[model samples]
Target: MPIIYRIAASIFLLLTTIPFVNGQIFEHPKQQLINADSLRAEYDKAPYFGLYKDNYFIFGTSLNHKPSKENTNVKFQVSIQQKLTKSTLPGGTYLYLYYTQKVFWNVLEESLPMKDLNFNPGIGIAKPLFHKGRYIGKFSFQIEHESNGRDSIQSRSWNKISFGGNILLENNWLIHAKFWIPIVDGENNKDLLKYKGIFQIGTQFMTNDNRWKFGLLLVKRKDWKPNFNIIGEIKYRFSRKADWSIFLQYYNGYGEDLLNYKMFKSQLRAGIVITPPMFSDY
Candidate 1:
């Protein structure tokens, strides 16, 4: 089997083998959607905003190299989004504005110099997916831009129009996927697509009471190549009542960061993370 399929199968087995307990302790996927909708309605006066993605700070050393300033480093990301519309639009879709920033710091070096900064901002709309009145997941469309802030030969940026969908299973397992078409290519990074694939997919599984979570992501490495950028993550929440958790991630392949998107790399990182109240109940 291909590496991608192997990772996927592993996640499937993990999610299936672990039994979610205390059915009364958590709401169904459909009910969670309803409650989210009701919560939105209650705060119709002001925009609802929260964390847009996993926020974490981690230190890592190359899996392919010995510990060194060039091979060891710290990485962090921050992402947030705000609802733009007070209520659902024509098709029960809600508009939102999003922003995300990723930074690479070579703190292991003498000067503690920074490596790269990726700025991501976008506008998107999302709608709930349902099967026989039961909410399943979400469908989203967005116009986004990402770039590593630099000048001339070193600068990189691109704009894309993307479509994404995910399946929420039993309020414990989630299968998320996205595909995007390049709308505008950066003059300096015309070959960016050679590293950043047009499509990506990931799966996440969480235990009941939201204590432990596992996630795996796969991104194609352009063309018909069998190789893929594989990212795996494991998180352990200190307490069900706290939003902070211990995060560990392993990444292997290209495009781990924008500045060196073309370089093949491998790393194992661990640190702390803060999830969103957006889905705290789950």
Candidate 2:
């Protein structure tokens, strides 16, 4: 059993067999994972998933290969993002689930006893365009899966797809991008494919009233060779649910044999998010 509880009981029986096999179109009984007036009407109608200011709250923690480390990688996460509709199912939809664990102790030279645990489920499609109500667009897809800990070692079951967007200037800035694809074909380990990627760029900011939020991410991978990655983030929201975030990252790795990946290592993350509030018709 123990293999992270059989991969978390097979992702809890595939999330209870996906609503009995899509019986009611994936059922959405007024979905409310967190309701602050339905997340302020999906953030007045889509503020990048309304800043997740509605639902999705589990927990998070991270500390990965940092400050001259030799394997003491620690990561723990539990996530949920549910909102069957508010718009998007047709072009911009959302349903995300996450479960992660990467624990390795100072045994980083790969003996044959290496360990890994990663489970991910994602569905996100976006096409929002609201100027007055504020919520930019152009996010296409993100499908993920990674189950590694050895089950025959075939790249440990893998898949990923991505396409991205975001553009909102003026009222406090916003810009985002993404591009990733790895439809199956594993084990080339170019420093984990330079954090595996097609490409990514990012930016987002909002302050005070919205409490606070800041972001930046830059990722690159043009088929190995000195690929790059960079990450920076900050977020804060006292009440109105809850939020706390911090992240710093850098990567440029490769060289399992001359492919040579290196950027030392840097990662320090702290996270917490809770939502539920904002419903008024007075």
Candidate 3:
């Protein structure tokens, strides 16, 4: 084995043998275990920042259109959330502030100009859902704004009110459903709902061993007619001790990019993803 691989293997072994988190032999299992002490350590810290969405960098090209500078590019997204208050507020909900940004880098084009930059920020509250004293899921509501940082005719911006939650279903399936009310007026995106969709619903399935995961998302456009955006992803973890995974994703439909929200496109992307312990972190 190469020197780097040998060193990583040694570290993984050592870390797994150390019972530093919740008396578990391997820290990876800690992603599924959370206790009072862990809660305090996470929520009571000086800076309570955690991952809000899956983060990744990908390089790919269009599957429907012929590959070219306009079709081949690199894409990336970074998302994070900060806990505004350590304790629950009047409604038994935790306050959170969030930010998520995405960039479409036209690496294949000459001069390598970026296609667009979508900036999203929001404030929200989350409440854990319980059924018959058993923890079932979580619900959240937020007021969010999304804009592509551009000047004049290139700029696209909108604000919306969103509410959604995750439910733990039978087996290894988890479902997430979110609905939004667009507040478009002077943003120059008055007809955004025709393509942006009124709501999004997705589900994920994970293997028992945690090595593989599959997911799908569907977005229904606002028009009374049939219009939808479909996305699917499958990811595999190379090692049990790591959070990173090899990711493959397919995007088909409109609204993939804020700058070209009306165009319909299809693409296949391959990349590496860092899976966050969003559920356990809380």
Candidate 4:
């Protein structure tokens, strides 16, 4: 079997086995486990300054299965936002800014030539949708730009309007969804929809102690012959007060980078995640 198939099967098996493991070992008192309301209150009280978002570094294989160049690579993402308007509610609106970059490093070669670089920057406003105790939710609308800082034939750039939301359920589960619409003409990226897709949806299953989180994300196009991308992530916090954690990530799909937006790829990575107390809390 192919490596991708084997990985997918392993993930499915692990997901199926997690409930049994949780039942056996995660039997702490219900009161001891942090609930959605308490978690929201804690995040609301946190000081809003300096790095107010999650940051991470991923090192993994490029896994470009096509007849193209493939190698090991590194990925980094940083996001920060500040409150623009204060409201009586616990979670309010804000101004947001985020940037993410991925670099392909030819580690097998002597000089480690970086094959490709993709940069994404987003800026806009965020607002609270609802904040009733354990059922808090927020949404953001942003004007985003992404590009591969190249010239001539290799240059790729586009601007988009994006909207996304984060909702914390009563059971401490989190649901995240986002959609983007390109603000460009056909001359720019006529085939972008074939690979980049229209929207993404994901869900997170949080442990009772708020120490461990498992997530699955799906990105797909809306056409009859659609393309899709899937990502699964697992993270474990070192301590209740720590701002960092161990992160394991897996991806199988296309559009890993702007340079290879139409290329299919798969990868597995392990790294450290700089996790703030709150994420996507407007």
Candidate 5:
């Protein structure tokens, strides 16, 4: 079996065992359901685990720029966030630590060559926006570092401060936008701004029952003239209670990966998305 299959099997086994363990801890079936609901509610209210900003896993493929050859590859991302402070700040602010790793694999190659690995770690603060209800959503500010874990000529790294927000609309529409400010000019990634740009915006439309979702993301950069990248995605839940969902993604333009940041490419892929996007809950 392939390594990806093995990893997926392990994760599925762990997920299946969680319910059995929880059931053993509870004396009665009714008590188990009650406790489970209570725990879930508490988790929902916890910082860094809320909707939109929650952690997720993604596995997919990229067609690359070559279609009639072995240029297509496997892609995956694992992301997580942890709450750093239980106590709220003066204005009800919450602090969090976040990390995400994305990788591309040339599984078809003889040696199973891994193409690129992008590691991102950040600290962020989130606060309620507007009237504190879902009307205006939430605002977040973060400083992040991203690198390819390479050295010398192959090194690619940068630091960015970002301001972002999640907006939930009454019609089951969700919007997320983020603006980035590069902090340091790393020797290997000095021209990153010309390709990555200053900001990105995404919006999603979800079904009322939260079973189906579609979203689009736009990334822009202005060097001599404006350049743009667009990503489109659609997802379907297996069931209301399931933690996994099927996802289809399409991308056009540049900056899909740090190694090929400046290369414009178009691709279509499909995989699983661990959790629903933020502001998807109604």
Candidate 6:
């Protein structure tokens, strides 16, 4: 095995095992654990920021955590994300922004995209976001723009804009609903433009620390398109400087079946998130 791989494996093992050995395990009262869902309730009642439900604004970087057959650690990116609520209510409108630097192995072989900047920004809104401490409803509109730092005169740019929303029902059972609409002819005046939609339902569960989220995503899209997809993710707080998440998405329609492009694709994505220390609630 390569030396780098060996080192990473050792560190991962140590981080996972050492915590248990040195940390004190909490013994909860029988009544609390036996109840329907006292975990969130206890934390929510805390005086300070306990059960925070605000949207997240994530800014950080990502690398080729998962590689295609021809691309080995072929890409690197720096991205910014913002998730804001339209209101302080349990259910409200919201927005998220994501920007990245993407380098293609076939296009830019040795160097990473961090050196040559590529940007993608999206804006959207979700309504009645999280409601009744259990269910949340949302509708969002999204637009994405991608461009390389190179001169506009040299090469054409890439951009995609989509509008859609999802309605979520949160409870111990975890069943929820989702829908998305892709608006074509919405970008630069290119014909052959079309719109797409999707709907899905699934369930999710919470873990001990109350810091992790995991769920199954079953989805369906327009016919003549790939519909089935499996989704899983773990979001955790690494420290004050960094927050991390690992996500796995497997589906049939990674590409545009309409254009006969990328009809099926599978990818794994992992990213770190950073916040302004001045604003963070240390």
Evaluate all candidate structures by whole-model CA lDDT and list the values in order: 0.73, 0.41, 0.72, 0.62, 0.65, 0.36
Q: How do the residues 87-116 of candidate 3 rate in per-residue lDDT, one tens digit apiece? A: 667766788898877878888788787788
Judged by lDDT relative to the true structure, which candidate is superior, 2 or 6?
2
Q: Residue-wise lDDT of candidate 2 within 1-282, one digit each (tens)?
A: 258547644543433323221121211112222233433355334322121211111222234443333333333333333434544454335543333333322233354232344444565554545444433333446576654445443334456776767665654566777676766444544345444446778776765355565666666756656455665655566543333323322222321111112323444534343221211000
Arranged by lDDT with the best first, the candidates are: 1, 3, 5, 4, 2, 6
Once model 3 is optimally superposed onto the true structure by TM-score, how far is the C-alpha of residue 258 displaced, in angstroms?
A: 0.6
TM-score of each: 0.84, 0.24, 0.83, 0.73, 0.78, 0.43
| Backbone clashes in model 3 | 0
lDDT of 1: 0.73
Report the C-alpha lDDT of model 6 over 25-142, residue by residue, as the tens digit. Answer: 2221121224323323322332211111111222222222345333322233333334443233244344455444333322333332222334456555434333344323344556
How far does residue 124 in candidate 3 sit from its true spot (Å)?
A: 0.8
Residues 129-211, candidate 4: write the lDDT tens digits: 44433335568888988787887667778888998898766555878898988864434456776677788888887777778
lDDT of 1 by residue, 1-282 (tens): 256336533533333322212121222343454444444444344566566676778998998888788989988877667778876787878898988778788888987777888989999998866665555667889999999978888888999999988787777888888888886467777888878777888888877667888989898766877868899999898775555679999999888888898898889999977665433211
Query: Candidate 2 clashing pairs?
Result: 36-277, 36-278, 37-278, 37-279, 88-92, 253-261, 254-260, 254-261, 255-260, 255-261
Model 3, position 225: C-alpha lDDT score: 74
- Per-residue lDDT, model 3, residue 53, is 73
What value does the lDDT take at residue 79 in candidate 2? Answer: 34
- After superposing all C-alphas onto the true structure, candidate 1 shows an RMSD in angstroms of 9.8
Q: Which stretches of candidate 2 lie over 4 Å from their true place?
A: 1-126, 131-135, 142-159, 167-172, 177-191, 194-201, 204-217, 220-282
Give the Å error, residue 282, model 1. 18
By TM-score, the candidates rank as 1, 3, 5, 4, 6, 2
Q: Cα-based RMSD of the predictions, in order?
A: 9.8, 18.8, 7.0, 10.1, 6.5, 11.1
